[model samples]
Target: MHGYVHKRLASTAAKLAVAPSAAKAFPPPDAIHNPRTFEPDTYAALQPPPASSLSALAHRLGLGLILSPTEVQQACTHSSFVSFYQKHYPKEPKPASNANLASLGNSLLGLFASEYVGASYPYMPTNIMKAVVSGYVGSKTCAAIASEIGAAPLLRWHRTPPTPLSPAPLLLHDALSSISRSIIALVYQHRSLPVTRQFVHDLFLSREVDTRAMFKFRDPKKALKLLVDKFNRERPISRLLSETGRFSNSPVFVVGIYTGADQLGEGFGTSLKMAEFRAAEDALLRVFLTRTPPEQLSLPSSTFSPTQSELYKPRKRPEPEYIPGEIGMEEMLYASSGKSGYLNPTPSLRD
Candidate 1:
């Protein structure tokens, strides 16, 4: 009885939250789902980086946006270096320096891109939605891109997390709003606008493609430099982050893996195409852009696993015309049948 009452109260709370009339019905949302899974603290500190820095960023042509100092600092500090920091100086105070701020600003801007994409395109399926967001959140991706522009000084920070009022991290925390502002500004100047959702989606998608394929072409910022140049002579998405001035080929991060549901892996493919497709597909499902079929996929959402999907009962068969309910087939075929609807006037199966 206690359990039953508790369940009723929980159901009532859920119903009240969503308004039962609005949604038909829904199970609880998965707590651990979403692309930005790492603790915000992972990027919280812009502690001073070691001299073994990736500061010599190769510049690519046609990246119109001016590279910010903070952006560069954030890109320089990679996970490997962070580990080194933890191993060596775990208890040192945060760096109170301009260089560190610039580095963190880069990361802040990169994450801002995803949030912008999400707010901009609500129709992109959840998978693509998550992919775009997560790609930007990627530490390697940020470092690679920032390395391009020589922004890999990996800024040091002695300050607290930026509050809501100050755009210390990003001048415009809202991505779509920035785009909207851009559109408005363009319209005001040119007296025309080509602000289509499809165009924006494609633009962002191209950026994402280049970002995921960063390790391929050497320079983080200029990975797609050649490709973008062929089309429009632009530096490409990779170069936008790598502002300092160097480009070199490196191994691709997401390549040739067989991760499913909660599982993750690392492998290599002989060719770039092979590696990228394999990685992207794995990433798509891993990021919950597409849901795994319940039977085979051991999703991370399960706190208790080795459990089956919710069971559903088989549909009851319809009654025949002669019987009040389903009369046994054996009785119907044989002459020694009991009183079914045919032998009785009361409550016919047909009724």
Candidate 2:
């Protein structure tokens, strides 16, 4: 058996050696072992430009001039662009992508939004708080803001052949939002927290949020019940504040929701049930529509000293002061509408 196997192996080797395509199948040992022969030349086309060019791009975005050229370039460069570049230029080193920067920016935006909303509206329900944060930093809003500022046009994308009737690519919106976040991250990296915070305020927080409209209760009465239970308060009682023209074509009923001596909210409607629902909604709004003065708002990052020689050093920062006042949805709306006689001045980062 051993002699037969040895003969078979010798025959196979002889046959392979005599084959016409054997050279094609296996190259010379030196050729096969050479590392430099197969190596490709390094080339990366979409590398970030010089500091002057990046600063020009930043100026186009209405940003105050700073010296974070590479960061700004990376912020604008999407992963799709990087992938495309790498695919076409296989030998080139992979350039920096915005994924990490976008992630960091997203976290920072969420943190700032949560801190602002939480401090402003301490008693706001969890669901409402989430909605508010979404309004500020959600993709839809970010995309809209990006497009409004012409950042969408400035976004770098991989060039591909256009197909007829192809589904519209979502990369534009995705890239725009990413670029926005990356820009924020870049600012935070190059500058101090206070500078980044100011940038966020000017860009995002300055926009007025419709706190009342944000509330979408499927059943206001049920929600009110749950809220009362959570607070360990007496069940809410709806009382008829007033009524007029009950038998006429036009009827109005004013209802108020109360718990013990505290009147939660009041509403006017055409019927008792409608008035009760409106009152419940009003009560929920009252509970959720708390606001703090912009000057008094505190950020969690303030607890850490940016000047610390070592990491995780606690700093002495003044605690945020909470001033109790209605959010005044109507006033905020009017102010947002650019109308005269608006009671509340628009909140400005400069303030």
| Highest lDDT scorer | 2
Residue range 309-328, candidate 2, lDDT tens digits: 44486546644444444432
- List runs of model 1 lying over 4 Å from the truth: 1-111, 151-206, 210-351
Per candidate, the number of residue pairs that clash is 35, 0
Candidate 1 per-residue C-alpha lDDT over 203-302 given as tens digits, one digit per residue, 9 for 90 to 100: 3323644323322212211212222222333231110111121233453433432222222322234445544544433332232222223243221112
**lDDT of predicted model 1:** 0.32
What's model 2's lDDT at 156? 52
Overall lDDT per candidate, in order of appearance:
0.32, 0.66
